[model samples]
Target: MTSSGIARPAGGAARAVTRTLSDDPLGGTVRRTVLPSGLRVLTEAIPAMRSVSFGIWVAVGSRDETGPQAGAAHFLEHLLFKGTNKRGALEISSEIEAVGGETNAFTTKEYTCYYARVLDEDLPLAIDVMCDLVADSVLAAPDVETERGVILEEIAMHDDEPGDEVHDLFARAVYGDHPLGRLISGTEETVTPMTRRQIQSFYRRRYTAPQIVIAAAGNLDHAAVVKLVRQALRGTPLDTDPAAPAPHRSATPAVRTRPAATVVEPKETEQAHVILGCPGIDRLDERRFALGVLNNVLGGGMSSRLFQEIREQRGLAYSVYSYASQYADSGLFAVYAGCAPGKVDEVLDLTRAELARVAATGITEAELARGKGMSKGSFVLGLEDTGSRMSRLAKGELLYGNLMPVDELLARVDAVTLDDVNALAADLLGRPMSLAVVGPFDESAFAAR
Candidate 1:
């Protein structure tokens, strides 16, 4: 039941089996052990480093929620820190900070993670605190109500920032009423009416052992981590067969949907923010490496086509970039820009022209080399922190079902040829565009253009 390429021994006592994922000199050794409880534990040993990052990842998020449970996943993230059976909210923060450590959690569209980083010597404390919070949170009625207002204010704060709000508007324009289109922090309408019982029910249903992974990196031993985790989760009854790893795909396959459209939100702002994009490839698509290369050259940085053309050449925008978001079944490729309200049309036109040009002729050889170099540099630099390593292991296990070596990932990026980028550009960029704009103008402002 383990992922492909990992060997699992047959018929053993309720224990963990370990396997090495990577032994790179630069990144250290990554090992994975699937606990009998179906909770996969992954760790990377970097003896040279003094800090360790521990994370508990759940494979459920806002997209897994029903309409009535819109913000339950994010809401529970807040409640988990309020108090566990043995520790109060203030105690939780004090314990971590007492050791000069940091603890936090974030909920995304597809998953949620609670993590802590501390000196390697204090790894045991970090693991115990995080596991206690995850396993034994007391979702008190008062705490739930207090957090509800906090979440509502978070929503209002996000609303005030049009630059940030426009991306949600873009997702709505592209995905329509689908779960992917909804905000991670459910709207005021959804959160205001949510009850404690509903939030607790959502937590019990989604926070099961089979859907969780524990990841650690930096100055650690595989066996020691497994022992600590086993002791930490000793009393909790895990609903899993002791003999097998959890099934990889538990939930039904996500429905893929894409609709080309435009959504404009009129607001009084100093500048107009717009996103021009279209549907893109999913996480498992083999062509993603090519897409990454294309994205880098197109709008990934200051030297990218969008940035150079819009900001450096034309001075139409102060900030402009392109990014791609990939999920289990669907994805999005977008170019975003913030400009003077009067320059919206020109910005859109120029952005469209760049897209068309790249789609038709593809990028130059110089662009291809530069894109690969940038991708490689960023990839390596990003993993220098223990937190990034822990994140990479958790995501690889939960999403890809295997941990790909750092060199292997770079090879995939390097293998992307000019033809690959060109072909991807011709296909992905040639699709119809969905535009989202947030400014003080009506739809009529863009109708004639």
Candidate 2:
């Protein structure tokens, strides 16, 4: 993929500039446009597709919140859909459903996304509703109170799922008081007393046009989608004084502060959920592709080492996997297993032994090839839908500031030599690890084990 000219408005007035970021060897094309207000719009046009996935990706998330503002980003997500100046909650859903489309939003550690998937012909409606909800939400008081109850219940639901809660506990065990380690949904303590004014302030301060990217993928024209977005946001708060788009998030050295080495939440569950890991590389690390390959070899799938030994061989655990979470400036890599409370020690031991073996001797050539193949195939197969494509456009602009083509990405994975994977494994997996466990045991349960 290569690009040509970027036509900025002649006078740099209250207008927009357009650029062709890339053109696939095939007929596919990806484009980027910067609005006068600094809001960005990126799109990939796939003419053969019959549906469109359009989204508004805000660069603010739970990590942007203060202690008192924990979950404020997520709170605003629910409130935005509750009602906007131009549409009520019922109208918002009914309008999308009327066209056989679906809409939803999710908040993460560093960003939030509100999206709609609809028939190609319904792009205009989808664009308008999304823009309105994102930029013109009234954030009424009554809606805040109502959504507060909803979010509290959501938090409760998350707590009941130990499998999911274990991951959050692992994060805390590694990062401690860092914002990145906090729960995205905040706890009942933070959410209960959080005031509407606090959330509203965060909304206005961080939800600026400069920090947002609007992306869409479908059988559509770039210019028309840009026009629709500009029109929808014409008089809203987002279309204010002209400014340049915000640069991608900056990275800083994340300090771990020697967080608790072991965190166990005593519960009465039949199965014990645990994660053993250490801090890993950042998203921009040059070794990321190698790490992906190494992850697959370690515990990425059913054929992975951990899964085969833990589940298929000894039947010590019903589920086992390893995953890496990368953020702008920091990351964590961990192995997780859910097993009978009695077998927790055995599972942990096997996981540690496997991790140590990989770190010491590295993966074989055969294992390396399989790992690379798995990594490449998963990356390509994941983009077989409009939603994933749309997400690629948004994330490219919001996180990396440039789009890497599918072929280039695959090539990166293939370029992972055995040396690369082994070096990363030695450096990453050789580090001291922390452990988090949630099960029917006292805090001292894992103290000895």
Best by lDDT: 2
Candidate 2 per-residue lDDT over residues 232-344, each given as its tens digit: 99989898887888888877655453544999998899999999999998888889999999999999999999999999999999899999999988889999999999999
| Span of ten consecutive residues with least summed lDDT in model 1 | 1-10
Query: Cα deviation in Å at residue 164, candidate 1?
Result: 0.7
- For every candidate, C-alpha RMSD to the true structure in Å: 2.1, 1.8
Cα lDDT listed for each candidate: 0.89, 0.90
Pairs with steric clashes in candidate 2: none
Which one wins on TM-score? 2
Q: How far is candidate 1 from the true structure (C-alpha RMSD, Å)?
A: 2.1
**TM per prediction:** 0.96, 0.97
What are the per-model numbers of colliding residue pairs? Answer: 0, 0
